[model samples]
Target: MRVLGVDPGLTRCGVGVVEGTPGRPCTLVAVGVIRTDPDAPLPDRLLRLDTKLTEYIARFAPDAVAVERVFSQHNVASVIGTAQASGVAILAGARADVAVHTYTPSEVKAAITGSGTADKKQMTSMVTRLLRLEVAPKPADAADALALAICHVWRGGTQARIAAARTRVEEKGTRT
Candidate 1:
């Protein structure tokens, strides 16, 4: 499966695409950041994000999109912007008719580094090693995005199975 992972932020949204399945070595298809000037108006920044994300969806044609779930932050403004950025990613995936899933930061970190409390350096090192890249992706965001993609590729099947089991339970009129 081809998965597009989005680490969304108003200032620097990270995007990465990977193709693989559970137990298979994943290939890095693409990785980059989408930057919007802090001075730019909110609408303009969102528009830029929308346009670039649409282009990515069209180009990569991913089977699924894995977005980082926005968690509340101390800075309300930052949290709001991140939630908005995440919405853009979900919208783009919907428009492309691709499944969109959200993973918490801890979930992503644990999937990549075997520990939810892994630091950025550890996460970066693991991502570099997993992708077999000569060096870690820069700016942290890029590496985080790739890590998100790897998480989805590695965990998606199990997640899907769990969801299916829940659905079956619900159909049988059992409380979950």
Candidate 2:
């Protein structure tokens, strides 16, 4: 499956694309950040983000989108910006008719580094090793986005299959 992972931020939204199946290595398709001027109006920033995200969706044609779930932070303004960016990401996936999944920071860290408390350096190292990249993706945000994709490929695939099985069983019972 091809997956697009987003590390949503108002100023620098990171995006990564990978193709793989469960229990296998994933190949990196692309990695980059969408930058918006901090001075730009909020509405314009969001629109710019949406446009970039839409282009990515069309270019990559991902089977699913994985986004970092927004968590409470000391700065309410930062959290709000993140949440809004995340909403745009979710909307991009929905508009493209792809399944969207959100994973908390700890969930992604655990999946990538075997510890929920893994630091950015550890996460970056793990993501580099997992993807077999010669060099780490830059700007922590880019690495985080790749980590999110890897996590989804490893965990979300199984979850989706189980959900599908349950749906099939329900349909069978209804038919009966």
How do the residues 63-110 of candidate 2 rate in per-residue lDDT, one tens digit apiece? 989999987862686989999999999999999999999999999999
Provide the RMSD of all predictions against the true structure, rounded to 1 decimal.
3.4, 2.0
lDDT string for model 1 (1-176, tens) is 99999999999999999998786778899999999999999999999999999999999999999999987853686898999999998999998899999999999988988899999999989888888888788879888888888899889977888899999989889653
Candidate 2 clashing pairs? none
Query: Local error of candidate 1 at 78, Å?
Result: 0.9
Model 1 lowest lDDT segment of ten: 71-80
Per-residue lDDT value at 18 in model 2? 94
Q: In lDDT terms, how accurate is model 2?
A: 0.94
Error of 1 at 108 (Å): 0.5
